[model samples]
Target: MTHRVSELTVAESAWCKSSYSSGEGGECVEVATCAAAVLVRDSKRPTEARLCFAPEAWAGFLQMTTGH
Candidate 1:
């Protein structure tokens, strides 16, 4: 299941930028882990909507992306 970040109480410090990010502001994203889900938001617009994914689903996504 997925939820919006607005529905959860995630701390600002919890967000971490992707290592692949150039840090020069080029389509970067941030991720945060919570008890119920893993959250994703645009690095440039964090206050906007954020996508939350179940832990299992997030693991699956990583596995698929990494092909490992």
Candidate 2:
């Protein structure tokens, strides 16, 4: 399925960044949780880039990243 992140209302979504996100916000990324999906976006460019993934996929990514 084709995922068009820009189609979604990112501003309305509550995006949260990883604790590991750097203070510079240059390489930092933010995440937003939704009922059907999770959104990953760049903190530096909130409206520029975004990636929307299924909840399960996002959870898997988070688990792999957090290593819990």
Index of the highest-TM-score prediction: 1
Model 2 alpha-carbon miss at residue 58, Å: 0.8
lDDT of 1 by residue, 1-68 (tens): 55666788778999999999997889989999989999999999989888888999999999999998
lDDT of each: 0.89, 0.75
TM-score against truth, every candidate? 0.89, 0.73
Off by over 4 Å in 1: 1-4
Local lDDT at 39 for model 1 = 90
Assess the local accuracy of residue 64 in candidate 2 as a C-alpha lDDT between 0 and 100: 100
- What number of clashing residue pairs does each candidate have, in the order they appear? 0, 0
Candidate 2 C-alpha lDDT tens digits along 1-68: 55566656655548888688667745887888766668887787877767889888877987998897
What local lDDT does model 2 show for residue 40? 83
Q: List the residue pairs that clash in candidate 1.
A: none
